[model samples]
Target chain A: MRDWRYWLAEQRGTLIALAIFALMFTIYISNHPAGLTTNVAQTAANKGTLLALVAMAQTLVVITAGIDLSVGAILVLTNCIASMVVTGNAFETTLGVVFVLFVGALCGALNGLIVIYGRLQPIVATIGTGAIFFGIALILRPLPGGTVNETLADAMTGKVFGIVPASLLMLLAIVLVVWLPFCSSVIGRAAYAAGSSETAAYMSGMPIRRGKFAAYTLGGLLASIGGLFLTFFTYSGQASSATASTYTLLSIAAVVLGGVSLFGGRGSAIGAIFGAFAFRAIGDLMFVFDFDALWQPLFQGVILLLAVSIGALGLWRVRNRLEWFG
Target chain B: MSDTTMGRLSERMPRFIRRIEPPVAISFACIILLLLFGGLYSSAFLSADYLLQQLKVASFLGVIATGMMLVILLGQIDLSVPWVVAAGAMMACAATAYGPAATLAAVPIGILCGMLIGLINGIGVAYLRIPSMIVTLATNAVAQGLMVVYTGGFSPRDFATEEMRYLATGSLIPGVPNALIIWAIVGAGMVFVLTRTTFGRAVYGIGNRERAAYLSGVNTRRVVMIAFIAAGGLSAFGGVLLAGYASKAAQGMGDAYLLPAIAAVVLGGTSILGGRGSYLGTVAGVILITLLLSILSVLQMPEAGRQIIYGVVIIAMLLLYGRSPTNQ
Candidate 1:
């Protein structure tokens, strides 16, 4: 294959995810009662953006070929923290926002430390940390009642220029600011290299550990960003287990949908964003069509199964069956 | 000839000793330590009756962990457990409305449903070669959705049949909960299969290296399929017992079991990467975890604190004993 062809092949997953999201979203808007009005668009954008941020976080970790089961817990914890601190005066709210982000970064760093220095598997370590994060969140708000700065929440969640969603714009800005630099950096390449083949990356003297750590820490920050938005949208924080587990699972699905390989060294956060949007759209499609709410889980599951099965198509092309183990 | 055979056995002893055996010991040690701690906390905790009750409770977890161990042994996982468990319970309960005969068939029907799910998981994983994690997760979601639709998004109206209640709660022998007996029977059966049968050896062979096993003329795909189906069926059986214990089924009943089941399996010293572990270690793990949770509840710690403790303990155990030569 030519270089461009290889690049396209590498990007097929993301592009397909984008296409799916675009198609679903178009269908969703056209069938809706309001017909793509700002209110409806803003609502969808707000909901989708929350998952997008978390999925981006998941993408970063997954690109390193490690999973973070605690991302959702971090989201809940930060949401709870933000609800308490992201209130009162403007200066205080700014400080609170910074603090919330820092806490998330700290949580990620803790995970990184355990996985890297402690040398534990990512899945078990994160499951543990996820539990701890939830515990802390539960302590923060025993009862789900807290307020955020309404001004900030409204501004971030509301529409921009009476049409485009502000949250959507923020998502674009995050991609440009956070993902672009990370994608091009040497450490990012190191992460990809490590994920693709750790032994080879180690032999080549790549700073694989540093790269992975950065991915994990950055993943935590992104999850917190999602938490911030979640608080903004709900105007409160809830220490709900159902929400936490759902987001964690959904983020993994989105990461896969976005064309990011669970095996690592492949995919893009931008693709994951689209994947998240598409996943959310699938649920909304049910709503728009007036399907019984009970069928939503079943519908989502079938679509996810089919979507994941598509990735398995490459297995048939494997000449050596042993490669399946890899 | 006898001397040479003895020498050969001695030569292999170290390798056998080194083969991830210490974690099982460590798990037992932890159980003892936990018991001591519990005893210190409350007099009731030290009572034989209380301890027996703990064992009975642990039995439920043990059954689920047993199935989890099989899949993990094959170097695979089944994330569909939670909903499969709930589905088994709900379906079995729903069957009871058909009267006595249906009530008698409830458990078998529930297990069959689980087996069907396992078959699908097996096909996806062994045949289609999709990752088990994704496939089972999707299955879980589908099962949950179906159950929700069946129940109309409310608590299930059907109750557990008389047989289920007897199996879950009744004591056939003094101080022996029927649940414990059922678990013991399942455990014994599993031990026999794992140790005595060609199928047992195949599970280990495949877990160690599927390609190698296939090359050696083992039906690797069939083995994988069987393992997954067994896992699904066992998980569903656990669900049935849980419904019996509760005398009813409720939404999300299986949700809480998934993590703990995995934790128990891992804590028992089974490698999450697969192809290495023991039923004995898992048994210890279940008991240890049950005690930990029981004590945490006795301490009146809030749910959040309990979760934190659970997570921390799991990580600690992994670090303490899960690391073996194979992990690297």
Candidate 2:
């Protein structure tokens, strides 16, 4: 029983977030009366997939003790580029998608290079890049109206096997194939080591600069995936229409809520996925309650504060208790 | 050997120039560039009227930057500047609606609002041990929320009055902005506080090492609180002037100042990680950034081009003056 208690405490943030999600789902199910239908489950799963992808990307950067303020900008820019290239043909759409992801990677690489070689602070560097990237997106489209091929969008958003959503499958593949291996690799281990103590990492002969660059580059790749999902869900692209800036903050909040420390060095990609779901679920619940639009930003701000505080408090408690345990 | 020495000297010159902080150097370069362009293109750039007009515009940003400089020196940031400015302007305007008695009350109220918000931020960071970035970001959201809820996204017409306009638009020197005078006074005051007061030394001490400062019995919390309150007051004053200049308060007016204020602080050589900075550098940074914008406007560049230029300037400045690789 004591061992179970300790295990539960170790996973408190994830456990609490899950509880909140379940509670909200229950409320939603009771109110709607079409409780737990296949369609409803698929919709929830689809939404969760999109958020999970971005949250996972966010987790990589956060684990390095850096925040990517430009994630939303990258998404918007990629979406804009994709919209501009989509001529409503399937081939063009596929080509455009590839081009968009490439652009996203390039953007991320630029950020990484600047932070690594140019020696700019991550938050400040990202902020400047974000503004520039968003500006380029605006210049490309100027307005919020662009058509995407409806067929492709539907395929990506639709369910597969009558049980699993297509989005969920993509997300699972990313986790199983990409993130899982990366987390177990030497580069990934070095990232956490660097985050925990840069001086010590250096003393230990870890490639700190290269690790940071890789972390940021990976963040960019994840952001591109998020952009693709966003494009799929919206079925179009609008430069001014998307909520990209909000997502940057949301990604950070989700990562932090999922037990990723802002100070870095300790968190999991899986935890971040759960954090994203918790955040999205809260918003879904708020919509169900008919809260005014103006109140939403305020509510989000309040919740983010609470989540960060809890995370910080939990870590502080654990550190002190562990010292006593020792 | 002599030829080698000359080559070495030439290489070192560019490095030295780069080390001199990009904003300051760029401001000087841009001024000369603008002057040359104006001489070639328009007769107006060298005109006293144009110079005075530019100074007037710079003053609004300058006043807020002055207060922002102090906060930045302590290695914390205030994202709440824009809202504080708007609130101050609104308070001043709202007071005028109740006649003279209310207008008198409004000034203090504006200052008080700034101080109160700063106190909240200070408490959260110092006592609760929350990160300043998250605390200030949340406060900014709250302030913006309050503004939207209170004003319903529209400026109150009754808030603007003759008295408020005098503060915003009325110049001490004909053709110079009254805001310039206010900025100068505030700048001088900050110089005094930063240099003359024991409290100022404490700020530096705390910024350098919070633990050491605490051990030495410096009230680190109080210093942080004071810095935030001062920032709040300054931002509010800037807002009041903004309301006057525009003839009314507007939503998102404060949003534009966030990047510029922080940019100015950093440009002025204040370290973002806290500890070691200068008010004079911030003053120079403010003038330089303001001039860069004015020059862009004078060139009649498209908004997109101007934004690109702004981003490039920020990046270039950071590259030039950022902490060295060895230091990191």
lDDT tens digits, residues B1-328, model 2? 1336545555667676645544455555655676677667777877888877777787789888877877766767776786787777776666666667877676666667777777777776665666676677667766766766667655454356665577778976876678778778888888888889988888888777777777788888788887888888888878877777888877667867877887777776677656777676787778777867777777787665655666676777777665434654
Off by over 4 Å in 1: A1-3, B1-20, B153-156, B324-328
Docking class of 1: medium
Candidate 1 residue-wise lDDT, A1-326, digit = tens: 46999899888889999999999999999999889877998899999999999999999999988889899999999999999999999999999999999999999999998888777778778988999999999999998979999999999999888889999999999999888998799898898997899888988988989999999999999999999999998989999988888898889889888999888899999899999999999889999999888888788778778877887888979998778766
Local error of candidate 2 at B3, Å? 23
What pairs collide in candidate 1? none
lDDT of each: 0.88, 0.74
Winner by TM-score: 1
Instruction: Compare the candidates by DockQ and give the number of the best one.
Output: 1
Q: Which candidate gets the maximum lDDT versus the true structure?
A: 1
> Lowest lDDT 10-mer window, candidate 2 chain A?
A317-326
DockQ, per-model, please? Answer: 0.63, 0.36
Compared with the true structure, what per-residue lDDT tens digits does model 1 show for residues B1-328? 1436555655667776445466786788888898888878777878989988999999988888889999988988898999999988889998987778988999998888888889889988998887788789888877877887888865555699989999999999987899999989999999999999989999999888888888898888898999999999999999999999999987789988877888898888888767778888899889988998898888887888888878887888777655434322
